[model samples]
Structures are given as structure tokens and as C-alpha cells.
Target chain A: MSNGVDNNRRHFLTVATSVVGGIGVAAMAAPFLASLRPSARARLAGAPVEVDVSKMDEGERITLSWRGRPIHVVRRGEDAIERLGEIRDRLRDPDSDSSDQPEYAKNEYRSLKPEYLVMVAVCTHLGCSPSFHPDPADPAMGSDWPGGYFCACHGSRFDLAGRVYRGVPAPTNMDIPPHRFVDDNTLIVGEDAEVA
Target chain B: MQNKSNQGGGTVGDWINDRLPYRQFVEDQLTGYYAPKNFNFWYFFGSLALLVLVIQIVTGIFLTMSYKPSADGAFASVEYIMRDVEWGWLIRYMHSTGASMFFLVVYLHMFRGLMYGSYKKPRELLWIFGMLIYVVLMAEAFFGYLLPWGQMSYWGAQVIISLFSVLPGIGEPLAIWIRGDYLISDVTLNRFFALHVVALPLVLIGLIFFHLVALRQTGSNNPDGIEIKENKGPDGKPVDGIPFHPYYTVKDIVGVGVFLALFFAIVFFAPTFLDLFLKPANFIPADPLQTPEYVPPVWYFTPFYAILAAIPDQVGGVIAMGLAILVLFAMPWIDRHPVKSIRYRSFLYKALLMSFAFGFIVLGYLGLKPATTLYNELALRFTEFYFMFFIISWVYSEPRSRNYYYGAFAIVVALIAVIDLVRDMAGISWIALLVMIAVTAFFLLLPAHTRLNESKPVPERLTS
Candidate 1:
């Protein structure tokens, strides 16, 4: 046994082989790790989208694609803004305290301005885009509806401020993306600004 | 076959042995693998999970041969397979039913581990690997469900993906990137198809391989919850362990027969029972413009979904759901009791385990229902009970008297019976009845908590 090999030599060989094997295994895993990241097309598609809310009529909502997701830009009318106050008691997050919104938009309205309510069109409940039901007395919404968005999929209702209704399946208010007004009518979604 | 030769048997086994240690490999994994002789009914699920996995892979390969992944053709293709392709319905049903049974077997397997404390020292890696397999199995199930492109599949995917969008800034964009489109469209279906067929399955197989390797290194935990290795025979073999080949192999064959009987029953007799497994809304093709009136995931995902729905905050619900699954990995550290089996655990621990199991079933049922006021309230209550089991199991691991456990068990059994009776009279769905039966069986089947009542004690010696 001594003539064949010594203990020191066996120990050195074992250490050498283990180190080499470890490196080989790690090298084999590199490509799989690299494959997990989003592809070039996905990254390009994720670039911030720009929408023009300039000609949007009062109480009318326009949905545009931002990062391939529907972005709701609703120009709230005076009636809609007033009704937001009425639905305060009935909202799950009336103060927007538990809502997911930019810091500037964390008020009752959950937006940069009171009139322009910018939010992700997707429902907070399950991602189904909610239909814009602005009229309080819209036959489908019934009387005392207090205009907002309604998710027909699971009956999750939200007020005009994007605040989820108390009895609705949606937990919090609709997500408010960070958006800054390039100007009064020129609205840039997905970019934040300093609100004085 | 020239078996007379001394150097080799001159057969295929010898032929392979000449090139590689094929016989040695078989011996190491099968014939020579030592398992405890005290394994019982709960022990069968590990092998049964492997069998269902093989069934899935085989049926999946055939389904992919004809199943279309495109949005327009995906729903129609499932119909075509059901009606046009010969024996395609059988293959499709096998895969579908096999998915449910895979979870059924795995949950029981994991429960067996929990009951016996199989995740204890030296076997931590084995448990983690098992957890990884469980998670990947869920991913596989989720991705595969999208292939049907039915209404439930589409909206269910939508709701689940939206959970990711609950994240503050990048959430919405991230969800879109995952879907590869604005909604669950052809791009989303195609990507999910790629993941379902290629990515997740490979990870699953790799994890399972490691899981087996780790389990082989540690041997197996027994019903007695004692380490068989501590008491060895003169030949350095575990005193109570039997060679896994003829003993457990034969036992596992019985498990396979029983499992297959139930699996085939679901496939052949109740393939389209919406309440049992499949959802009725899934028959319609996916329509992005119109959302289904009622949308719920398959039964397996309902517990987490219920927890998700119970929370009033979007991010909070997501976190709770995530924790519900991830918390299982911490069981090893959480349960610091010296004993491995619940047989030696305190009464409180046993009670906690029962409550946790019952709450899980209730949460699952509530998750399937629409978020009515009553359902949401009940879900929230059960979620609290569900999470409390883990916390209590960890904090109170000290042993207590058997009399206390018996009292706790009696109370629980009585409570379950009362609830079952009330729900029955109230005209609850068949699912409630099924849960009642499962709960009754769970309580009735509990192993003895004291030495005197123990039906099968750990073997004192390994017999030939």
C-alpha cells in the first residue's frame, strides 16, 4: 500500500478533484441562470409608454397601453370628484392609507390632481380590467352607485378615487402608477414629479 | 447466456457490469437500500408521487403531440383531442386526474414527514429538496392549466398574475413581462406552454433526483420516530431495517394498486364532474373582452387563494399567501422537540396539528366560493388558525401526559362531528361532506400517543 501511494498525495488529489468538480458544476449552471432574465423584446416592450390626455372629455376615461398593461386616464368631472367624498365611509381604504400609490398621490383622491385620476386599468382584485362606470345612476350600477370603476368578473367595485369599496373582493384601491404632468394636458404615465 | 464463466455471468447484467458498475448501482439504490420495517400506510405516498410523476410525463408527451398551444387553436384543440383523436380523451383525463393525485400523494407524503418529524437533523437537505419539488410541482400545475385556454384558466391566470402586480412600482410591468402581452393571449399561452413543457419539468426532475440522493444518504424515518441507525447489528446494518427490495417493494405494489384504482375511478367515472375537480366555466374558450361571471382556480390552489382573499390589503394578502407555502420549509427549525413523532408530542401540539389541517380544508372551500361577507369572514378566521399551528408547534414542543392528548382528541372529534351534522342539515355541497369524512378519518387514524396503546412498536431487532 505504501509503495502504491502515500496519505498526503491522496489527500491533495481528493482536494484538487473536489475543487475542479465544484467549478465544473457551477459553470454548467451559468447558462440556466442567464436564461431566466427577460428577453430583449420583453425589455424593449417594458419601456415607459406615453399617452395624450389633452382632449379627454370630462367624466370620460381613456385606456392606453403602458408596458403592455392598460393605463386608465380618467378626467373626473365635478360630480365624480364630489361623489368621491360621499363614498368615503363605504370605501375599504377611504384615506388611501393602505393603498398602493405614489407618495404625492396618497390622498383621498389617489392622484396628482383632483380632476385627473391616473391609475392602472387592472383590477386590484384579480387583474381583470375594470369598466369605467362614471355615472352614479348608470342602470347597471343602480341608484347610489356613486360613479367609479366596476369589475364585473368578481363584482369588485371601486369609487372614482380608485379606492376599493368596503364589501368588494378587491382588497385595496386600484394601483396608482407614478405619473407626472409634463404640462396641464400633457400627461406622462410611469414618471413622477414634485407636487408643490 | 453463458453463466458458467467465473469472470462474468455472460449476460446483459454482466455485459453492462464490464463497462460500468451497473449491478453495484442497482444494489445501492434498490436491493441493498435499507428501509425501516415499521413503515405504514402514510409511507406509501413517496413512491406513489414518483409513479404519478411518471404518469404525468408520459401523458404530457403524448398530449403535446396533438394539443395546440396557440390561443385560437388551444381551446378547440382540447375539444379535438376529446372528440376527434383516438384515445386522446383517455390520455387527457389521465394527465388531468394524475395532476390532482400527484398533489394528494405529495400532501400526504409531506404530512407523514411532519407527523414523524422526518425533517429533523441530518435530513434537513432532504426536506428542503422536497419543499422545492412541491413548489415546482405547483408551478408545473399552474403553467399546465393555462394550456387549456378555457375561461377559468384565462381569468385564473389573470388574477394570479395580478397578484404580482400588487408590488408597488414594477409590479404591473413585471406581470405584463411575465404574460408577454396585455392579457392572457397567444403570447402568454405560448410562453406558459414553453415553461410547462420544458423549463419547470426539468427543474422538477432535477430536484427529485437530488431529493432521492439526499434521502438515500439519510435512510428513512420510521413510525416509532426513533433512529434505527443508533442500534446496529453485528453486520453494521440497522437492527430494525429491512432490505428495501423485496420487503418495501412488495408493500409499495399494494399502494400502487390502491392509488391506481381511485385514480382511474376519477378519470373514467367522474372525468367532467365540475364540483369534484374540473370547473364548469373552463369549457368556454378564453375571451379577453369578456370576463367570466364567476372565476375560481382549481381546488388545489384554493387554500392560498382563500388566504389571499381574506386579507383586506393587496400586498398583505400576497405576502400571506407567499408565507403560507414558504413557512413549511422552516418546520425543521420551528419544531425543536427531542422526539420525532407526534406520538410523543404534547396534547397542545397534536391539537394544533388537527386545527391546522381542518382550517386548511375550510380555507380551501372558502377560496372556491365567491368572496361573500360570510365567506370572507370565515376565511379570515381560518387563516389565523392555520398560521397559529406553526407558531404553537414551535413554541410548545415539550412533552405532556397522554391523558391530555386523549381529552384534546375527543373534543376535536366531537367538534368535527357537530360541524358535519350542522353543515349536512344546512344543505352544504358534497365537498363539505368530503371534508367531514377526511377530518373524521384524520382523527380516527392518529397513531397512539402513549406507549401502552401503541399498536406497532419499533422492531427490537432486524430479522432475516
Candidate 2:
């Protein structure tokens, strides 16, 4: 049993390394991603980056970095929009499980708008950054793997609502950090206490 | 701890401590670094790559001094160097063409690594770091190319930068932000110039140092495909090995010196001598409304460039290109063949290399294009084959040396290709493509499923 614990630690470290590496690709990319450095002072001044979502078509995700972390704000597909209306027995948290948000965010979809699902893209389990495993039935993930955050760490699964799957290593759903839209294209995080 | 042991007027303990603790250990192992006798011209490519890296750094440092990061001065500065600066033309070509030569050495180096099991355990870091070097070199080139802010440079960057648009959410904003505005503009150019000229070079140097360190630790895996570590001769030295210090270094200098002469020639006489050098039309400030006619990357980048451009989907193309390079790292573990050398690999593996080579050349040709239907289709087809060959050749090539006859034929076919490339470039109108196709055919015709008769001697005949 002690030997098993050691092996588990080794496995944990291995998984952590891959997660770090995968995210490292994105993190290292931040500095060089844009031709211009996001002026340190201006960014530190805490102004939200204004995006033009006017051209963004539905069902597409546009990634934005908030303070160096990837904020994947995906527009819901028609089916996903409908799926949110019909919460099933699969979600471990029957009604948006963790109340880690303010009163305004305690909703089925857990967002300011029904069409857009905004959540901190990092996985709740082991902090291994989760990939938005949007397609529920992707063979690479599995049949039961719902359309959600499939953390490569310990194979944890979360639903599209960011609710953790039962029996998953992830003890809770992904954090939906407080964010409110200043305009249709502009989102301000760490502000608007209701959204925060 | 090691430096303190000096003998002069010092105690025995102090004297012993002055030398590297490994002095005797390294000695016992003959420094454990030696090159095999059979390592031929192909073996020199890695060191040649190192040579170009040095050339690039030296020339790049000088270029950086005069190079302005802003778009307004970037193009003019390049022109200034070409027209005014003494030997500025040489510096520019040396940098530009050095990019191509760097790829040549790396591809050959990678091929050398593949042929030998250089990615095997204990030395895996070497190959991994080498792969990092390759990645840095590419990023370095891409960043530097933007410094000139040429038409193709701008638009090519535009198309590549836009690949991020496929990300599910935030893609548009990220893409926009990445451009620093709506498109690849002056802001993008200046920052890219800094990263290209300064940031990426630092990363490349660091990666190269690690790569060489790892390589020295394991020593070179020679043509014989034997691990010198497994057997030590009576003299406690690698039997078929030669010291890298004076012996191979002197020999490698000939390769390096000749390469340098060619380097000087490209730098001075024909800075963009080969239209492959891509003249300054690429340097004109980028106009978003007008895309350059036939926008293609530098020739060396063409194959993977072709593969990326050929993908029908934006995100798919980017992922495919990234995976293509990443896939090389797994070559050691994935190549299940018991035999290390291609000379001994069954008919399938030999065929795979040639096909991969052919696919690479075709993909390269396609990458430098506007992606017409025909070219796009061909590029896509070759892309599949490019990936499939890596997967197949890596998995299938166990040496059943009774098939040595097949191996010889395949090698001869590859040789014919080299000859064809030479003769055509020599203005002989030789059908290089057809020969390369025939090389691919050599792999396609492999009798992998056929059971060989054991009575076959499979003797020393396979070794050149």
C-alpha cells in the first residue's frame, strides 16, 4: 500500500508536468503572441481588453487572456442552448452544485447571458488546465464524457454547466469567476460585485 | 570541491582535489565520446547546423544594431544595408540564406537522428532539446522574416496569425489583440523584430547548448548502428571509435569550411541570388486590402508550410503543422523496429523514409502557394502521406535482413533522386519529381507481409 502511494505520487507529478507543458505553450505564447507587448503599466492599470465580438459568429469561441490566463468565452450552439434548458440527472450538482458565485450567477447555465457561458477555463481538479471538451460523445474522451471540461488530470469530467461529474476526481465544478459585460463585446472581470 | 586539489606545495589530498573529480572517471571512459568509422558525410550535418547557428548569431548581432524595430525604418534599414553598408549585402544574405542552410542541416540532423536511435533512453533529452532548437530556429526565422515586413512576410504572417481565429471562444478578440489592432501592422512589426532579433536568439542559444551537452554525453550513434556503451575493447576504449577532439574536428572543419565558402558566396554575390532569396517586393509595407501574388514562405519552410496551407480548416491546418514537428520527438519510442540502421530494416522502413522524403519535398513545394484547388488537393494528399509515412515507417520497420536486397534497391533509388536533384539544378532538365516519385514507389511496393525464408544468409552484404 505504501508502494502504491509512492507510485501515485510519481503519477501525479508526471500528470502535473504534462499539464504545465501544455499550458506552458499557451503561457509562453502570451508574450510573443501579439507583436506588441501588452504594455505592463497599462495592463496593470486593470482595464479590461475590449473585444469586437460583432464579427464573431455563433457557436465559435474567441479566446482572450485576462491577466495572463486564457479566458475561453464560447458562444453556445443551438443544441447547447437547448441542453441548458433541460438539466439532466447526470450533473453531480443537481442545481449548479457549488454556490461559489454571487446571487446573480446562481442560475442553470451560470452566466450573465444565456447564450454565452463564461467560466475560468482552468479545471477544478488538480488544477490541470481543462480543455473545453465540447463534443460530448468524442470517442477520444468517451461515451459518458459529457460535453464539458475534460481535465487530462485523473480523467476528471465536468458538464457544460461547469458542474463536476459524479465519481470524478474533481471535487467540485469549475470556478465561474465574477464577470459582467460592459457592452456586448466588452467584459469586465474582478468588478461588478453582483457578477463578481 | 574538485578545484581545490592542487599538488604544487600542497598536500596530497589538496593536489588530488584540484583536478575534476571525473578526470580519472572521464579518462576511464576515454571521455566516453567517440565517432564511429562508418559515419559518412551525412553525419557531418549536425555540426554544420551548429556552424550555421554561430554564423546566424554573429551576423544577427550586427544586423540588430542597425535594424530598427519600427515599420517605417525597418524596410528602409534593410535597403540601407543592401545599398550602403560595407558588406551589408553579405550580412543580409548570410542571415537569409543561413536560415535555409540551418533547415538543411536540421532536416539532415533529424534524419540522422531517425536513422540512428539517437532519441533512445538517457539520450532522449538530447533529441528533445534538439527538437526545441528546431522549434526555436523556426520561431526565430518567422520573427526575423517579419523584420523586413515584406509583402509575403506581412500577408504570410497575417494568414498564420489568423489561424488562432478557430479557437472556440475569445478567438476573435485574441486574434485582434495578437495583431495589436485590426491587422498585422507597424506595432506588430516592431515587437516581432525585437523577439525575432533578440528574444528568440537567446532561446536558440540556450537550447543548442543543452542539445550539444546531451549529444556529447551520449556520443554519436554511428552508421554501424552499434551502441559503444555495450562493449568496451581491451584498451578500455570504444573499439570502432575516434576522439571527437582532433580527429573528427579536423575532418568536420573541411565540411564546415566548404559550407562557409558557399556561405560567403550566397552572402556576397547573390544575396537574393536564387529567387528563393525572395527580393524586396516582400519588403514593401503591408497593405491589408491587397494580398501578394503567390504568397509563399522561404523555400526551406515550404514542405510543412505546404502542409499547413493545404489544410481546409484554419485551426486544423495550424494543429497539423504543429503536430508534424512535435511528432518527430516520438520517433525513438514509436519506432518499434529491433534494428537501428536502415541498411538492415525490412523492405517497409526503407520505403517509408523515401516516401517521407518525397512527401516532404511535395508538401514544401505546395506550402509556398496561393492554394489553388489542384495544389490544395495535392498538398492535402501529400500531408496525409507525410504523417502516415512517419507513423508507418516508425512502427513497421523491423530489420528482416533477408530483405537486404530490397534495402539496397531503395537506397539506390534515393541516390538516384539525389542525382536527379543535382542534374536538374545543374540545368540538365532532369525530372527530379519523377525520380522522387519513383523513390516513393519503392516504399509502396514493399512486401512487408511476406514471410522471409530463414535459409537466407543475411550476412555482411547489407553493410556498405
Q: Name the best candidate (by TM-score).
A: 1
For all candidates, state DockQ relative to the true structure. Answer: 0.19, 0.03
- Would candidate 1 be rated incorrect, acceptable, medium or high by CAPRI criteria? incorrect
TM-score of 1: 0.73
Cα lDDT tens digits, model 2, B131-233, are 8888888777777778876676776676566556546588757866775654466767876776777778788778877876777678777665667655667
Worst 10 residues of 2 chain A by lDDT: A122-131
Q: Residue A143's C-alpha lDDT in candidate 2?
A: 63
- Model 1 alpha-carbon miss at residue A140, Å: 12
* Full-model lDDT for every candidate: 0.78, 0.65
lDDT, candidate 1, B244-338, per-residue tens: 99899999999999989989998999986555467787888876655676677788888998888776555767898999999999888888777
Q: What interface RMSD does candidate 1 have?
A: 6.9
lDDT of 2 by residue, A1-196 (tens): 4745788778899999999999999999877655353454435544555555556666676666554345667777778767765646655664665536545666777778877776666544323346676776688775655466665423456777677665443545676766778777777665653433
Model 2 spans with C-alpha error above 4 angstroms:
A1-196, B1-32, B394-464
